[model samples]
Target: MKRSPMKPGKPLVRTPFKRTSPMPSTGMLSVQSHQRTAPKRKAGLKSKGPVSTPIRRAARGQDCTLRLTVCNFDPDTTVLCHSNYLADGKGMGLKAPDTAAAFGCSACHDVLDGRRPRPADLSLAGLEAAFRAAVSHTHEILRSMGLLDAAPAAIQPTLEHP
Candidate 1:
């Protein structure tokens, strides 16, 4: 018997197989391409008027005396607030539900919107805590006004802490 020249553990014969051509280049290969496409709308269209209508109606005729400040030190300085402006102006009030839009005073709104520098005494966590409280308050107001159903449970905040 003749010993194979290859290593003792290695196979003596190589398998003959034809290599197939590369796959067709469909643009779908990259995830970005899929994401670039707009989401499909539902078959039957349900018209929910402007998103701000409910929030505005809820706060309408009501005084913006809600204290959003971390410390209720200066009550007189607080001004009427409408929308809680996002730091980045991308989505504005649309990021969160109508409940998230609370009547914050000008001072507090400025701090949140980065129009005015945040006070050294207040931390980001404290500001966020205040915002959540405002959202909850707005939810209650909406319920009272009959804009939102009181029967259903409130939606949880999307922002999570580590």
Candidate 2:
């Protein structure tokens, strides 16, 4: 019988072929084969890939507050949180159901458990100051990133909800 070459201190015994789990060792590999299998749990929405994502990349340096700051309104967890925002930054227009961070007080109800009313409703006269601030913020955000050169028209929100 011919034998293959061996290194200085290696063994020659080979184990039978079988699949092993990625779990920690349980003293014996055989134990894995005999172990009870739990019911397979379905991966759910909360453990998701991404929700409320943006359409276009935030022009240049503009921080996509809608997409980036999502710890509050997790579209995954809330069934009530009508997610029209994920396809694109549509809610930013304040016309759609999705991109309404600076525009939706309704979202405050989602995160704050209804303790605080919606912060930025265009209908409220008091929020005009806030609305202008948002416009300015948008303008500055665009200018800084060099996207304002051919600036998209300033968004003039109406009572209309698209």
Candidate 3:
């Protein structure tokens, strides 16, 4: 240990670093590649571009489809809540796709997300059934809004001129 001259006993802020070997090198830099590369994704996981942002944004101001006893039914609080079911592609650190989502209020979202307790009369099976129904209802709304691919074609009005 090196002592400070001023204090006579206190050590300096940092100990001097000693190098035992020269810095390692890979090779000469190539003209084709100089930038760092991203880490590889885990096996079986693949990104197909970003998730549906338009559908998510369209959820704003929509009615709560879950309509659980805990549902606030506030349009201002309505948003697209992804499915919690594993069959819907939900997994740890991964959410279900927007197509599998439903329009839900903050209260319903909390119940589905397990942040809040479900209704006393509602069982796990009942909750699951309700979520499935809500998903269907949400899909209907999306279809009516022409957001989903399964939406029916709009009828064009023709004018009869004299």
State the C-alpha lDDT per candidate: 0.58, 0.40, 0.88
Cα RMSD to native, each candidate? 16.7, 17.5, 13.2
**TM-score list, all predictions:** 0.45, 0.25, 0.62
Residue 69's lDDT in candidate 1: 47
For model 2, the superposed segments whose C-alpha errors exceed 4 Å read 1-56, 59-116, 119-123, 150-162
- Most accurate candidate by TM-score: 3
Show where candidate 1 strays beyond 4 Å. 1-52, 70-95, 151-162
Please count the clashing residue pairs in each candidate, in the order shown: 0, 3, 0
Q: For model 2, which pairs clash?
A: 85-98, 91-99, 105-118
The alpha-carbon root-mean-square deviation between model 3 and the true structure, to one decimal in Å, is: 13.2
Question: Residue-wise lDDT of candidate 1 within 32-64, one digit each (tens)?
Answer: 333246789996475566545656554544544
lDDT of 2 at 139: 51
Model 3 lDDT per residue over 66-123, tens place: 9999888799999899998899999987889998999999999999999999889999
* Candidates sorted on lDDT, descending: 3, 1, 2
Q: Give a tens-digit lDDT track for model 2, residues 61-108.
A: 333223211235433332212223334244553333322223222333
